[model samples]
Target: MPKRILEMTAIEVARLREDGDHSVGGVSGLYLQIIGASRCWMLRYTHLGKRKRMGLGIYPTISLAVARDSARAAAALVQTGIDPKRAREDEREAARMHDAKQLTFKQAGEAFIKEHEPGWKNLKHIDQWKNTLATYAYPKIGKLLLSQIDQAYVLQVISPIWSTKTETASRMRGRIEQILDWATVHGHRSGVNPARWRGQLEYLLPNPDKVAPIEHHEAVPYEDLPQVYKQLCAIKGQAARALRFVIFTAGRSGEVRGMKWQEVDLFRAVWTIPGERMKSGREHRVVLPPQAVEFLRNQPRRKDREDLVFPSPRGTFLSDSTLSKLMRDHKINGVPHGFRSTFRDWAGETTHHPRDAIELCIAHVIDNKTEAAYRRGDMIKKRVAIMKDWADYATSETTNPA
Candidate 1:
């Protein structure tokens, strides 16, 4: 007859070993042992003629009933010819692979920049891409795994700003597409880049061009030129003086604001705006009108500064936005830049000057290469006459009858 073995506590099991019961052969059939040191039950079994062991946890953590139940489950797997050890190892490997596949959109974006930033034309181009992505895309999708990204999430990022800030949204979408493309090619993700527009997101979102149509360039009408010019002249401020200088010289805001005392020759009645300052990167000379000359002469001279005629409050070069804001503050609607168009309109309508002379006065490239190559003269005489007329028209009374 087989002898029955009672369940043992951790203390009883330790005492059994201490009593030197070496001939206790029936204990082998008992599948559970209580480790005295840890006060935990362990299950021992044999599968395919090989011995195996599994922990059933501590006394308090795994109750006696639960331990026996768990041991029966492990035994069932053994009887079915499965190795629980190998199954656990496979699960761990799968988890690791899943982690590796998960990468955030921000991570992909940084990788994209690293790969293609070197091919960019210049540092400014690279900075533009980085700034746009950081400002718009990163906040929304930065934490989401690359594979998890979809069109809805991308739309969420862009739609809020799309109508009001079309240009920024357009550039942001392009940057996101570039990053997702990089992720797809590198095997971090698979599928159409969510940022793509052609077939993917085209129907979902409003067309940017339709949603935000371009407003016509703001310019004062040619007929209202004299009255507007008079108003501009009557205004007395640094900004007004700067505007008058820009109109008188027919130069861009940058060129006029960047002017220096050394660039001017008061005796010669000329201001030589350098090639770098000119939009065409070719040096151009302006014959200063008597009003422009007097305006410059009356300006309080700085004792030490070499460059920058229109300095800010700290005496550095004025920001490019300064003039635009000044116009806004004064409620001068139409394009502040439309002043250039106004000048062009006045030149065409009021004078018999050649097209090339007007274009040259505005620093626009004379498109006819043959004429450009052959025409060496600067058309100074005609330009001088044009400048005088502009000054007269800007400062004089309205010619139109009320």
Candidate 2:
């Protein structure tokens, strides 16, 4: 029969040190130290006629019982002709691969922007993506791996600012979802994107549009328009003239700022804006009213200038914000763009002008295709009448109540 070794305590081991012989029972084999202070458990093993040493664990922390269990498990692996060290190394490699698949949310967002920014029509869109994401989302989960980001982290990023800045928060959520979806499809992440909406995240958050309704540009009442128009006329500056031109042509600030002298036909009382400058990317001819034509004629022309009806003092075109700031400085609460809304309100409430003709005069893309196709001539005669009425009303003493 094999010798049965008794369980020895720490105190007994210390006493055995004085006696010059010590042995502890381990599961796989015997714990023996050939010399004092050089303590180790030797697992008796022979593989293919070569002896091997398997150190169990260090003393104190690795208790006698646990060390014995570890030695026994190591021996079992050897018995099955498997190398335990190689198995541990394989597990470490798998852990590294799993970590490699996860990407930080900020990293994925930047990648998404770089891939999609070139296709965007507006240059401001790219800046908006960077500014909003960096300000809001980056501070929260910028370091977290994409796969580790759950719905709770997404909520934390948006919920604080969601109510106050509803539209921006809504856009932020959409951008976050887009990046995460890209990560999932590209094999950098697994499982559903936590930022997704519809049935998935609908239950988690409130409808953004419902929280903050769309705000339309407030239109000046037609009755008060003459007073406002006279106030605008009272102001004397290049910005004032540019703003008046925008009001007269019913064109956007970009269109007015980008207008060239060549497009204006003074003899014929017309201005034909080119396709590139126009928002619709279609050439639009504006039938200049007597006031509109007179305003352009009185505009001071710079020497050696070839183009640009509204050139700055430095001979460059005026920026879009220049006229808007001038309006605000002059105590005009609304802006030059608000004049378009003012015109629409007057046409709707105070004038007999047809809706299609008014929309066409303003270069608005009317949805009725057949009507648009048939009305190829732009109803110039009717538009002339409408413009004359608008000039008269804008300069006259009239008031729209409410």
Candidate 3:
């Protein structure tokens, strides 16, 4: 048993500030430690043959009376074989967990976004996350505690939109699941994620693909493409000319719209689209036919806007809707993008082009892992022949008699 020092008054304890541990104690091993003008209450004790120290509280926030009481209680626990420091740590961790449980869904979501935003590559994706959460989730479950968010709350946000806006609803459910998963990992919540899609949400909601069958872009039939191409050439303006270029290359509208003069090599008859501009995140080379190379050579140079090959009137990249509007005005049945499908249909139905070369013309991702691993080359030489046939067919007045 440790000896108890004589109990001192508050005034005596305050006066003994010689920068060392002083027992101004009513309890054994209770101390008022002073070092370099810093004063704190420390309880010094032994448990199971090991000496230990525990910070009771800081003074003058914790007075002498309160310090003695804390020390006495801690010493009692020490006598019962409990390490006082470990007991204090356990209590504090429990309190922290309880506090974390009270965090609202919105708070947790914002924290998750903030933590991950730096690593995210796309700004549009970030905007979509913020927009969807604010529009659907915030009104429903944002204010609810993170730990309290269950299947019922997730269903409330997703059910109303599931059948009507299946795509958005599916994405929102995924985002909610990720946020909840992040919270669980950080100890803010527990249990299976209610927004998870597999065995959980699968039973709760209808399958997304079944609810909203994919509607492919409206494409002009291959037989009707010759007439459509003739009408497109008759129309004047940069947008019309750009549409012609799209038909010649069978490239995406965004890819054509954002095409730069630097990317085009008229001498070599090739267009090299940088990975950043391409959807696949890999650089792609487009084989330009003689007609397409001639068209490029004839294009007027804009000295002030030298970088872009197809800059809009304001000298910026053309809006996505620009070509679509041109088609609408000309009473064209299909979208500008649907031209790729037109080319694919024509080549598959009429020509002897290989399926792989035709698909690569439009930059479609190779799905088969084994095939993708083996096929490293872009087959630019094969596509050169394919593009020539496409351009000749597009410009010729004679339609396929078959």
Candidate 4:
């Protein structure tokens, strides 16, 4: 037996009260249930000789008319052997998938770095990527969804700094472009990257060099080397010796900082810097003059497995800035790397050594790849003479025991 049907009205629906369901007859089997303070609608019916209930919504939110309409629809689905509960769950899952596809720019940037950071050559590059995003791009559009980013948003990140801090802005633009491309490839985003330069951003921003010119490192004048050499030899301690060796060897500060005792062969009189440590990614053989070899043999020995030729006080490879500070403290205007320039000038002007031999001494990649490929020998005989002469001239002004 069942109650006869009339359209359920708002007043009759509000009067619903009981410990269980109160039938509000309109669409068949529709019930208004009260449990404590909560009131909701449900459709009750039998299907396949089994009774089931499906929630329509809460009271006040789903009015009597709306509840009846929804219950009738659920009843229709049940009549056709469809489960409303499972259908609702499927609908919720689809909504979640849509939200996930709208990944924010910051989220995409972090994912990009995670995928690529392991392959990057230096830890500093990771720091650079994170720092640039935090300072520029993150504030501008990081919260926006990946698909929301456009050329206008990219301009917002880069335009202000493009002219004033050109180098930093250029790096940030490249980083943003890379992150967008990564997102697009992964299907989190689509279409051309707004940060791209070749066809898109290039038309928007001015050339970087036009805004800020590349500046060469300042060098010590070749004629002033005698006095500078004298002053350098007078300083005491391991850092001073390291600085002198950096100049004498014409090595990059990074190479000198990480120099190992094993890399030097005193008997052979050459320092073999491996490809991994060199910027050129090729093993370079620097022929040590007699003075250079004598200086190295006299250095304090260590018992550690990887004994550093010039270790810091903490027994680690010395900090690259250690030599820079040494020069500043001594009131020399030239940087440690500027010594290579001084060596080049001296080689070009004073020595009769072949240009390629001089280039090899300083580890420059010779322009003629064919010649470089064919030449197996490092011209040890000629290089030996040139190195000896350069060493002699450098030390000619300073004979004081250091």
Candidate 5:
């Protein structure tokens, strides 16, 4: 028979200051473990002929009354053939998993961005995601748990901006949908995404297209392009040269502004834009005409492959605004992007160039998948002839309409 241990009162337990384990009565195997200044509650028990110690909690905070109850519960588990220490560990693990799945909306968005940022080619795109969420979504549902978010919360973020900044609001809604989908896939959230546009959100929000009609960039007419080209040649500086280069190549302002010396080949009359730099995510080979080649030959050469072809006065990438301002200062009608439209009109209306060749020169993606698959080569020979003819026509002295 086991000897009966005396149970100690709260007052008696409080008086224990010796630096050793003192058995606190009312529960078997319960002790006040005192080591110098440290005091805590520890339970000692035997499982399968081996003794084990388990920490209930720290002293004072987990009082004598609470410790006794916890010890009894642990003892009950041990009596039922379970290791109380193992059972407690399992409970802690389950709690950790539950907490992990309760991530806030902002937390889930940040995690999703971090996970996918490696695959994103542009840092600006990553910044855009962060900025949009911070500006709109974060203020509304950032702190709310992913499981708690619904259509109402999503509308709270985007509704005000929907009618005013329709495009931005539409993009924000799409991003929210993606983040919610990512959370569901990762087990941080469950249920249908409230931000989805196709079936759910479509019924709720008014059509974005109807709210704000799409606006194309204003372009110069092809008939006036020759006169415009002549006037552009009169303007001096890198921005003017870059604008001319854009027109010559029929390239986007962003593409031309970010061009590096390595991309140019004066010897071969080719400017190869790598897939990463191109909007289509595919390499584009531009066949430079004599005028375009001459323009490149005259620019200051650099030893560094990464040096910008048209750098700013500070020796950095030229801003799109600089080119736009140049056009404005000289009273040139239409924006810099308008030149692409100008080039397209000239090629389509005036020239006898094949439709495919003209489209390829402007780096336009073919709408027909079968046609694109069959047209494997870039048709560089056709493009070279077309560009030369366009350049000659642009540089030619034409009488302005009287």
Candidate 6:
């Protein structure tokens, strides 16, 4: 017969100093195993006539009361004809899977941007996303789980600035909605997008158009163009030349700044801006006047691929503020963009030319589908006369009106 073991007291368990194993025999196969001064609880049980040992936890770290409870639970599993060791392994695997699937809102937004940024045309667009999200969305719920970001939290991000900075806040809402949609598609999250505007946020927030007042850029008067043009011409630099070209062509500042030598056809006196550069995503053909062509020819524009016609001091693309800073330095009371409006006003008030040709010259999107289609021809011959007249009027300071 085997000798019956006595259940050890708390004082006896505390007195244990020697290494090896000590059994407190109220429960079968429960031991306080001490090895080289470290102590822990282990359950030595038999399943299917095979001895199996399972660790409960460390002594003093996991209190003896908790260890006893854990051992009894493992013992109960054995009484139910189940293996507690396999159960514990299954639990650990489940925890690993849960951790692997977790995604924070910042992580998801970054992943979404990385996946889609290659397809975007403007490099500044990525900066826009980073700046807006970092300033607004990331603060409120960036570290929160994707499943945790509900519409209430999204509203918290946009509502404070929605009325004050309506356009920016509106754009932020759209971006957040897009990120959530991407999350859903990739299986990181599941639900109708909380940031969605039409059926959700639109009802909560006031329409941006109704709340925000329209503010147009301050434009130079038509009669003031000669004076502005003279000052721009007198300022000698790439930024000055870029400004003059913008005013002369009525093109966007970005289009003028991003111009490569390859895009200009001086022999034909035409500059073709590719679809990717134009805001309308269509190629724009600008008829260069003799003076305009002459200005460009004097630029030492070598026929080299990717050579910018107007590069910054470092030979990279000029910053957006380059022309504005020139305007400020000369104390010119108008902005670079304001020059486009100056051209538009001049075209409207000073010319007898048809409106369609002028709008097409500035690359404005025509409202009438039929008119827009006819603009495919873009009235090039008529535009040459108009642009020449504009160039002559702009440069002369006192040219007779055509």
- lDDT winner among the candidates? 5
TM-score of each: 0.53, 0.61, 0.78, 0.68, 0.76, 0.67
Model 3 has an lDDT value of 0.87
What are the per-residue Cα lDDT tens digits for candidate 6 across 265-357?
989999999998987778999988888887887785544445999887777888878788888888888888898898888889989988888
What does the lDDT come to for candidate 5? 0.89
Please rank every candidate by TM-score, starting with the best: 3, 5, 4, 6, 2, 1
lDDT scores in order: 0.72, 0.76, 0.87, 0.85, 0.89, 0.85
Off by over 4 Å in 6: 1-103, 163-167, 184-192, 207-212, 302-306, 370-376, 398-402
Instruction: Encode model 2's per-residue lDDT on 1-402: one tens digit a residue.
Output: 223266666655434443222347545454644355555545555555667665655555565677667777767877898765455568779999887777898888888898987666445678999998999999999999887899999999888988999899889899888888899887888887788888776887788878898877655666777787777777777777788777776778777887788899999999998876666768899888888887787888776465777888787878868887887787777767778888888887888888888997888877888877776687888888888788777767523101
Better of 3 and 4 by TM-score: 3
Off by over 4 Å in 1: 1-130, 138-161, 171-207, 278-282, 319-322, 325-331, 367-378, 398-402
Model 5 Cα lDDT, one tens digit per residue, 303-360: 5545999888777888888998888988888899999999999999988999999999
Which residue pairs in candidate 3 collide? none
- Pick the winner on TM-score between candidates 1 and 2: 2
Question: lDDT ranking from best to worst?
Answer: 5, 3, 6, 4, 2, 1
Q: What value does the lDDT take at residue 311 in candidate 4?
A: 83
* Overall local distance difference test of candidate 4: 0.85
Per-residue alpha-carbon lDDT of candidate 1 for residues 224-292, written as tens digits (9 for 90 to 100): 766765676666656666776777776777777778888999898889987756655578888887777
